[model samples]
Target: MKAAIIGGGVIGGGWAARFLLNGWDVAVFDPDPEAERKIGEVIANARRSLPALYDTALPAEGNLSFHSEMADAVQNANWIQESIPERLDLKHRILGDLSELAPETAVIGSSTSGFKPSELNEKGARAIVAHPFNPVYLLPLIELVGDAGACENAAPVLRSIGMFPLMVRKEIDAHIADRFLEAVWREALWLVKDGIATTEEIDEAIRMGFGIRWAQMGLFETYRIAGGEAGMKHFMAQFGPALKWPWTKLMDVPEFTDELVDLIAGQSDAQSGHMSIRELERLRDDNLVGMMRALKKTGSGAGGVIQRHEADLPKPEAPDLPITGDRKIPVSWTDYNGHMNETHYLEAGSLATDRFMELIGADANYIASGKSYFTIETHVRYLSELHAGNRLTIRTQVLKGEGKKLHLFHFLYGPDDTLAATVETLLLHVDLTTRASSLPDQAVAEKLGAYHQAHAALEQPEGAGRSVGQKA
Candidate 1:
């Protein structure tokens, strides 16, 4: 698919990175001469962080081009995103032009934070509010508000690129999330202006407190837990009355005076001026990846979004042995030596074994039927070092497969196509309830037999069945 980015500032660059990293060819039309450099930096950050969020590799990055003319950028584009400044007249003019030039089937998404779709389309344009948070590649939520048909068309496309399309039920100012954000933003400004909390203190209060809760459960769910066995109704009865109290200046707006700007900016500089913006972005991305990965375990919030999207990613295919595992080495998998930790090699092998099991019908359903393969033994031979970001591919060969026993050989190849590692494993079919060895199901046995026969013709993999410290 092709995406046209009508602007290439921070948000525009982020949209481009999100589309491009997901294997969509991106054409960017930004008048700024430095747009390419700026977007390249954003993509560089995305390339490091986005792939780390997944256990499997993302699709190969698509082509990127810079166009001087808007018409050239939108040519044959499937999605056209406008990320120009937030002026209504400017958006109207640009979106109007885009609707005329873009393909009839194209979906035009405006990255407007505050404007409603009705206002955007008033100038005879077909545009939807596709507001995404900063670092759009990693953040999954895209608030979509517009024509029902357009939103329906965009939702699947957004999902394909690993985004969560939240369809707004009605046209409202600032859509959904931003409305809540603006509320908190207003309160925070008041706190800063009224000598209550410094910028860093407020940030610490959030990152060290409710921000973590909000990341996983959001408002109502977390409060439900706080209800202490009585749930939301009881908690609301107790604390809902506090809503009338003047605990927050949520409805008040802090004047944007020069002194206030200087106070906040100066305090912020003191708190984090040592690091560059890129450094801060990297730190933020790393933290988000770690948090999101943790959430994946429980299918919480953005983590659940990632899990669903990963299920749809294409499985790798090989002509001989199947490509059971294909992914980039995330930074978290590394050790003090700046290379992939040894434990992860075994983890990768285990994942490959799981995939191989699924290939032969020993999948979730079969396991749920009280029959599954349990690894009895494993031997790993490390041939080369793997560093973070190196792509790893595991090809499996079914060495022996029979009624109750299974033997497999896995070849782990690094980015250079060199032999990085080898894992030899043995597993036995078992009844989960009894925890005892059992005969494989007839269907599973037949599938395994076919692979075993096909692999019989190939030469014995080197170092297979080798004992520890043995000579080659």
Candidate 2:
């Protein structure tokens, strides 16, 4: 797929890096003379952060081209993302031009804060408001509002690049998030205006406590959990009365006078005196990636989404026998015969099968407690000689999995789909402590059964393991 990003500053470049790294060609448009340098910085950071989110290798980077003309950037684009300045008239002009040059099949998204879709469509051209945060590649929440069709149309494409599109129920100023942010900003201003805490101190308060929880589970949900064993109602009954406290004026707005702005600027500068903005941004990105990956361990909402996205992400095809890491036959695997050792061929095949099993949720944890499939019998037929680094893959199929036993068949193939060997194994579930034949746990049985059921329709291999009850 191809994506076009307008306004080639930090956000635009982040989007470009994200799409390009994920195998989408990206074209960028920005009139600024410094676009190349600015975008390069963002891409540099993205290159480090995005890949750090995954363990497997990614597809090769896609092509990226800069365009001075908006039309040139958007030509033949499946998606057009606008990240220009937040001025309304500027957006209207760009939207009008995009609507004219881009095809209807292309989804147009705008990164606008506080501008309603209604306001943004003043020229009678509809575009979705897709307000992605700065460092657009890292933080995945995109506020989407416009034609319902537009949101539905763009959600999957947004998801493809590892973003979550959140749709607002109705068009409102600043959309859903900024309202919360504005509230906090107002309160923080009041605090700073009275010198209650410094800018850095406020940030410290957030990062040390609720900020961590909010990363995995957002505010309201966490509060709901805090409501206790009885849930929301119980918590509300216990603490909702604090809402009427005379000590606080909840809705008062402090004036954004010059004094306040200067104070904030001075304090923030002092707080971040050590790091340049670019350095700080890189720091933020590194931290976000770490937190998100840690969250994925728990299968939290966003973490689970990333986990699923990574799951569906395609692994590169392995090169032809002895399929190992990076599709390159390792030097150590070579033997005195100059071909890979025979045992290592089986070892490689086992490794490939093991990797495949882990992909489907079987791993050491599932096997360590003596709840593993023990091979009861095996038949391997070598059809062709394999030299060192001669490529190989195993095409495997389940022959039978009924009650307590399973039958599996594998065909080892080399380059040009040449058949090199075949393996068949009959397996039994056993308890590790007693080493006795045993029935699989219900969950294990169900998983095996599901796999067996899914592959039940395949044709039988040329040779299969003999049943214990039937003689050859």
Candidate 3:
């Protein structure tokens, strides 16, 4: 799991943080003296944000080294991620060097946003266009297009690094992301040039509303939902007429002259002039991570991608009833109330248990099939007060899983690893379609059985449920 990142710019640094934090050894090569300082800032932001996006335990940070020589960085690495600036001959030279030094073992991935792999590999190297979005540490979509052989080999490698490789069946200039971005870019020019909207207003229009929906469900899927009960066919019948409107010229492409680039860049600056590039990027990454993780619960596109990642990832083999953490307070859980309110604390404990369940392998698609297990019964003993800033942790164990029910014991801890509360809950797998009491399928039963076999056997709790939760 060694990765060599050539040309350590913003994208290169992002790839470094992503691979390093995800338990892959990462070495970076960029002769620029400022590379260290710039990459360090990127990694610092990446460190705080990436881990917080997930409740499950992340892989340990792996080895990182910076080399002056490209060959030194490329050697012995399983994946060579290239993120140099957008210049064809420069990339060819580098790819030629990479192809010679580490030709067979590692996959050569280009961060080139626009160029096709065939054109890029004119120097006779097997390369895949692994075009990742700006913050490679977050946005999971990596537009991959290249030789079929290269893609076949690279898919599993990309997955190991927590990337979603959407294979473009044909070679096209600017690939997927940049192509869509170009459409917006063209229209945005029209808006700004015509004074129809200010640059900032246009961005706000996007970021504030429809932009949110696009993350979970992209354009076609979003349109499918807008179509109502009858779905896409109905939607098309209703709205397809609007395509002829003067509202848009879908075929228009803006000339990227100096005037246009400056216009857009000028507007962007005025829109976000208060923040530095680093600050803006950090804010962007944080927002993207939060939104994407929220979407992951539904096992939507990026969510489904994350769902699979959390499945293959390994967790520390702690005690069967291990107290992984115990803390006095965290600022996030506290509301305006001096004492912790009821719902958030339940949320916190449930989050901890959910992570535990994920560690034991209950994933989104598993829960999505309308046969999810839910907390059917619960008795919470809040022994000590919880404040806004009071840190808390929970200990959990499967007390029993008999027939269709699960008895669980949760011990909440505060400062000094002291017990704050004890919650005993019963869970049931109900048929999502029928909303009726139902036993879990054998696959789930076997997983629960494994947990039962791993832990010390115990009797069913006194209050295990024969029915669903009141809310359920």
Off by over 4 Å in 3: 228-231, 237-245, 249-266, 323-344, 351-394, 397-472
lDDT of 1 by residue, 2-44 (tens): 9999999999999999999899999999999999999999999
Q: Which TM-score value belongs to model 1?
A: 0.97
Encode model 2's per-residue lDDT on 233-266: one tens digit a residue.
8888998888887644448988879988999999
lDDT of 2 at 396: 62
**What TM-score, to 2 decimals, does candidate 3 have?**
0.78
Candidate 3, 402-464: lDDT as tens digits: 677776777777766667666777777678899887987787788777777766565544333
Best by lDDT: 1
- Looking at model 2, the pairs that clash are 114-174, 320-391, 320-392, 321-391, 321-392, 339-388
- Give the range of the ten consecutive residues with the poorest summed lDDT in model 2: 319-328
Can you tell me which runs of candidate 2 are displaced by over 4 Å?
246-251, 319-354, 358-472
Model 2 — TM-score against the truth? Answer: 0.73
Q: Point out the worst 10-residue segment of candidate 3 by lDDT.
A: 463-472
